[model samples]
Target: MLSTGGSALIAKKLGEGKEREAREDFSFLTLVSFLFGIAILLIGNIFIEPIVRALGSTDALLPYCVDYLSVSLLLAPAAMLQMMFQTFFVTAGKPLIGLMLTISGGVANMILDYLFMGPFNMGISGAALATGIGELIPAVIGLFYFLFTRHSLYLTKPVVRFQVLKESCFNGSSEMVTNLSTAVVTYLFNITMLKFLGEPGVAAITIVLYGQFLFNALYMGFSMGVAPVISYNHGSQNLPLLKRIFKICIGFISISSILITIMALVSSPVIVEIFTPIGSATYDIAKTGFFLFSINYIFAGINIYSSSMFTAFSDGKVSALISFVRTFVLIVLNILLLPYLIGVNGVWLAVPAAEFMTLFLSVYLFYKKRDVYHYL
Candidate 1:
């Protein structure tokens, strides 16, 4: 949300050819992200134990949670900075560089995960530290790159613009809401599954959802990559080019949704096998749920893109409304009502139902705003 919000403004500024203002806003975002990181670090440390407990960690899990949280908090600022630069880099017309930087960070994370957890035997703390350092590398490198480079977009004199900051926050609220709703929906799914299928049920659901996460990541990356272009064109009032981009993006998402759904169905066994052995109870449950849950991808891509497109257009309220309805309202309703209606299968179908229902709203919003955005 932060990254996209900042990128929307910066991309628009670039389109307007206000290079100095763009750089200043870039600096503002970077500064804000850093301060937020520091705030998180301080608050997290101060209430670490209570926070862990509030998250429902039992006594047995408390020690491990504490260990992980303690190490992770140290890198809070870095994490924030990393997020800001990821999209800002794209706004700067260096999407490939952003991709490379992220890939490098992921590689560093994987390497450190192995070394720290295996050789050093640092346990959860090792994992936390590895992730923290991974984020830190990008944060530091991005800071240096923007600060020292002579690109179209670079960090300049920090001029805190209150109105710009407020707009960014408002524009990004939908993404934040989506994330928060995911957490809430996950909790709801767990409870629903537990009531219907017991402990093994929850485990199966988790494994299947992990597959969804992997596929959703691809959709998210594509949406984010295209967002800046959309914003830039919209800001420039290049109706013809903006319309072309919109058509291409929507077309690609539609095709990919069909392909992803088919792939998930075909690869269900393989995906399930990665987490459990064949013939195990968990394996059987997950395989079944995975197939049923795979139906969601067919509808999810368009819904995800709808919210992102609105954000790029700087229509935060409408974007947030779409996200809230899709991620929270519909999902919650389905989870609560479906299990009772169709038993165990209903639980697995909850997300698919939610996504399918939300697609109508997404399509409606897109058509309704076509005239306004001149992208019909």
Candidate 2:
């Protein structure tokens, strides 16, 4: 929450002091930032296991998690880089470049996934490599165009401002925190599920959890699109526009939640087939569990984006509190309560239960902050 919202806030700043502060010309800076994304994601891919190992919980469950996590983190740096640069471009009135960079990279990633997953015999590592290389491609292209071709909005040079870097980090820290929360929760779930459900159970949870990520990405995208609008309007003191944007964002959230739920349930067998085709019944069961897990999307969408809305306005405490409700407190309750309630199903039901509770939590938080946010 804090990282994501803060990044949006930082985007708000690009419209301020940009010309003089753009120590590097727009082209060079874009290139540098693009490089930064590739570097960061690569770091995440290479270091993820070591970071997990540093926590000192090397159960049998650890190995499997390391493989799945490595693949996703392969693209995380590029994703985060997008967050930072998107703010930069949007503020400069060149949002289209950022959007094109993201969409193109994502499409390329899918193509690479297919190529490496089979014909290249890279297996999991191949998938990771494909995603990582795919992510860097458009970043290269975007940087090339920015540096060699297009006119940047306000940037002038590629000078280092420790302050700008710090601000960018600070602004985007909420996303870091939110994702870190995910990593922690995943760790806890893996360990705990292993204790009760065993390795197969843990694997099942993983497949379902990946489905969760897809749903999360959609909602997060909505937040991403809305963040700039919120930041720009609030900065311009256009409260009415900001409020309208927020309302429309909620609509997006709702629509996504509903669509994700329907799709997951209706397509459960097909979705399951993606990871577990025929040989492994355990994998199939895991996919079934994944289908069950998608039930939480609607509530999750409401709770998460509302938290983001708070952070965009620079209310870090509120943002943190809201995140705590969904990520920490609700999860903890599920961890403690669910296993006792319904056995294996209890474990599967835990997420939806947590999301259900967080929906109310989000509304309450919104109410408490209504006065502060009423102008928007």
Candidate 3:
């Protein structure tokens, strides 16, 4: 929500030549995000045990969950800041700096993971600590940059504008919905997997989900990276540029979708093997399901991009509707009905079915809003 709302508002302000207003929005967003993060930190820690148990963690898994989340929740503020700054960096025309910092954080995470798990033998807590610190690195650096340095965007005296807050929240609600729905969908998948095939079924789904995350990151990253430019063009009334960008985005998404689907299909066996030995029950299940699951990628890119594009245009209602339906409504319906209707294969088919249906909605909205946004 912070990233989407902040980026759109900031870019629009910049496009309007309202530099002071842009900085004020950025500073306001930064303050609000920090406060939200602190709230999460407190609430998460206070309810950590119940939250973990509610997720269906077993007795064996409870300790590990507690250990990890206890430390991880402490860095909620940093995580929130890091997420907000990523998009803001692009808005400020410092995308490369943001990318480099993120890469550095990832490198730090891997190194720390090895050291903590292998050398220090800190177990799950160590892993959580490492991850939290990884989040903190970019967050701290980004915060300092905004606070101390002169740039297109920087910290300023934040004017408490209720209208701005309302607009930002309303405009970014789709992203918030997307995130919340992911958690819900993941929980449902776990419960359904457990019912059908026990632990092996759960393991199999986990493997496929890991692959989903990696593959879907490509679409998500692209959408985020281009959102500021879309907002800027829209704000500046650059209709021609908006039209060109829309065409380029659609073309890129179309081509990437096909290529990613092919890559995923060809690499399924290797991906499954990485998690489990060949011929194992989990391996067999995941390998077979991966093929079916990967079909979602063919339609997911367009849906993802369409929702993001609407958000960039500051049409929160349309964007939220798209995200809510695509991620939660259709997904929940399919996850519940499909598995019962067609057995385990139904489980694999649920996401693809949802994404395919969502493609129609996305296209309809794109066509409907073209004139409104002047991106036809």
Candidate 4:
């Protein structure tokens, strides 16, 4: 919420030729994000056990959770800064640098994971430490860049502005809601799967979710990548350019959605095999569910883009409404009702049903906002 919200505000200021205001907003948001990170670190560490338990962690999982979160929470500050810089990089016209930093951090994390877990025998703690260190890489570099470098969007002496903070939170609420709702929905799915098919079902659903994350990441990245452009154009009232950008986004998402769906369908067997041995019970369950789940991709891109686009345009209320409905309301309803209605297939089909229905809402919003945003 902080990152995208602040970035959108900065983009608008920049479009209006108010560089100093943009810098002020950036600095203020950076300070707020840092403080928020610190709070998370302190609170998470103090309440780690209860938090894990609340997430439905079992007795057997408690120790591993402790070991992991004990190390991981230390990186809360770094994680927060890394996320903020990702969007700020695009706003500053340094997106490629951010991407390079992220890639480097990821590669470093993988290497560290192998060394710590395999060679040092550190187990889950090693994995957590590796991830924290990996996150720190980009976070540290981003801090240095914004603090010391002469850039279009660099931090300055922050002037406390409650109004700015409020606007940022409001504008970015959809992102926050999306994340929160994802956790809740995952828990619901796990419980539902456990009820229907036991541990194997939980494992199967997890594998399918992993695949969903892999595929949906592309849409998320695309939406984020274009957000600054949308904000800038909207701020400048460049209707022609905004229309062009919107068309391009829609076109790109449409073609990519189909391609990604096909790719997921074709690779379902291989993906399931990677997670579980072929002909195993879990493998069969995952493969079947994955095939049905892949159908969501066709509609997911549009829904995601719709919410993100609204956020970029600073219509946080609409953005949050779209996200809440798509991710939470419909998902909970479908997950609860579908399984009772159609047995095991209902669990597998819940997400697709929710996403497909959300498409209508997305399309309606696009049509309704056409005149206001001039992006139709």
Candidate 5:
């Protein structure tokens, strides 16, 4: 995923032939990325049993893992390209384009879900495939549209030099770190759940996490919306307004997080029920998980806001570090420790713990770098 959002950076690097070259280059890069992801899933599927066996997991869980990965092949390209577009639009400060594309893809995904997963009876695999295609389709369209039409930031020279690739990867690391860490934390959640409470524990945690993401999808949009503004203003040395925008954005996130945390606390069961049917143990566990883990937003919102500061400043190192702390460190450590103390229930608190720790670090950094910030 290091190269996941390279399309945008490559677009930025185009000296003359901005859109035409970017479109063509992105088409190739996107295709290659998509193919690589599909290949990973296909090849990874073959080794599922061996990997599970090596882990001493039950055979019952082996099939589930295989099924999940296989189905995920459909989403690989879409998810990858989604990240690519996100970086491009956010870094370029044109998040409206990405937001429009996202909403379209989301709606398309729903339609495909119904057609492929419901009426067609493709089940989970259908759902996965639909979502996968949905992700990549808009990217393809958007890439073409941006390139074919004239724009302020047209791809001047869409050459695929190593320098171009290197820079793209470097610029995209901030977004990639955020996503990769999410995947890592999710794995940690599952592992801790299994160790503490078994399959039911894992299922519950998974559903709760999913419910939180629905709102986060919007938060992601908001963050992307603000990225370019923050970055562009900083580039022009706009400090006061930078602080003002940051304050406004953070204030919005805080209010939203507080509201969501309360909602999660009150309607956790309802939230879980949206994904899992009632009267089943999975449903019960998921509901329980939602109840416990829903308030992670308050902390996560803070971490995300902090990371945006670095991304806006074009400081991938700080962005990555902050992301790693909120995700990898807090999540893994909590999961590893809590289960030993109180059992699977501990996994639910991992997100919040991670968020709080990261928040402390964010505040510390704010004070340490007080003079480094630019006003808008």
Candidate 6:
């Protein structure tokens, strides 16, 4: 949410030829995000046990969760900084740099994960430490670049207008709702699968979700990359340019959705094999679930793009409404009722069903706002 809001505001400022103000807004938002991180850190430290218990951690898993959360929360500020810079870099017309920084962080994470967990035998503590370190590297680099370097959109002394903060929070509410809904839905998925298929069922769902995460990350990257352009055009009232950009974006997302869906279906076995041995119970369950879940990718890309498009246009209410219905209302209802009607297959179908259902709402929103945004 912070990243989306910051990118939109900065892009809009740039479009308006307010470079200095854009830099000020960027600095302000970065500070706000870091403060948010500090708040979460305190909360996590104070309520780690309660939070883990609330997450339904078993007695056997409590110690591990506590250890992981402890170290992870300590670097909460760095995590927020990394997320903000990833988007801000794009808004600053340095998307390639943003991608490189993210990749650097990911590579660091993998290398450290092996060293800490395999050789050092630090278990969950090592995992947490590695993740924190991974988060810190890009964050520190981004901070140094923005603070010390002269760039198109580098940090400056923050000029806090409470109005900017308010606008940002409101504009980013949809993304926040989407993330929170994901957490809730994931918990429900685990509970529903546990009821039907036990620990292996939950493991199967995890494996399938890992694939979903990988594909979704691509969609996320694409959306993030284009959002600044949308915001810039919209702010400048370049209707013709905005229309062209929107068309290309929708076309790209549509093609990518089909490709991702096909890949998910055809490569289900390969994906499952990466996580577990073939012919194992978990592997079989995941393989079957992957086939069913792959259908969601087709519609999910469109839904994701729709929400992001609205955010880019500063229509947060519509974006939040779309996200709330798609991620929470529709998915939760399907998860609760469908499994009862059609068994485990229904569970696998829930996300696909929800995404398909939300696509209609997305289309309506786009058409309804076409006159206002001039994008249709």
In candidate 5, what are the lDDT values of residues 285-327, reduced to their tens digit? 7776677776677777767766766655656667767877776
Roughly what TM-score does model 5 have, to 2 decimal places? 0.83
Residue lDDT tens for model 3, 129-226: 89988899999999999899897899889988878888999999999999999899988998898899987988899999999989999999899999
Candidate 3: which stretches are off by over 4 Å?
A: none
- Local distance difference test, per candidate? 0.89, 0.66, 0.92, 0.92, 0.67, 0.91
Instruction: Give a tens-digit lDDT track for model 4, residues 296-345.
Output: 99999999999999999999999999999999999999999999999999
Model 4 pairs in collision: none
lDDT score, candidate 1, position 91:
83
Candidate 2 C-alpha error for residue 272, in Å: 1.4
Tell me the deviation in Å of residue 161 in model 3. 1.2
lDDT by residue (58-147, candidate 6, tens digit) is 687789989999999999999999999999888989989889999999899999999999999999899999999988999999999898
Question: Candidate 3, after superposition: displacement of residue 100 in Å?
Answer: 1.1
Q: 89-139 in candidate 2: lDDT tens per residue?
A: 554566687778778777887888888888887777777777776667654
- Work out the TM-score per prediction: 0.94, 0.80, 0.97, 0.97, 0.83, 0.97
Runs of candidate 4 with Cα error greater than 4 angstroms are none
Q: How many angstroms is residue 249 displaced in model 6 relative to the true structure, after the best TM-score fit?
A: 0.8
| Model 2 regions lying over 4 Å from their true place | 1-7, 14-83, 86-96, 145-171
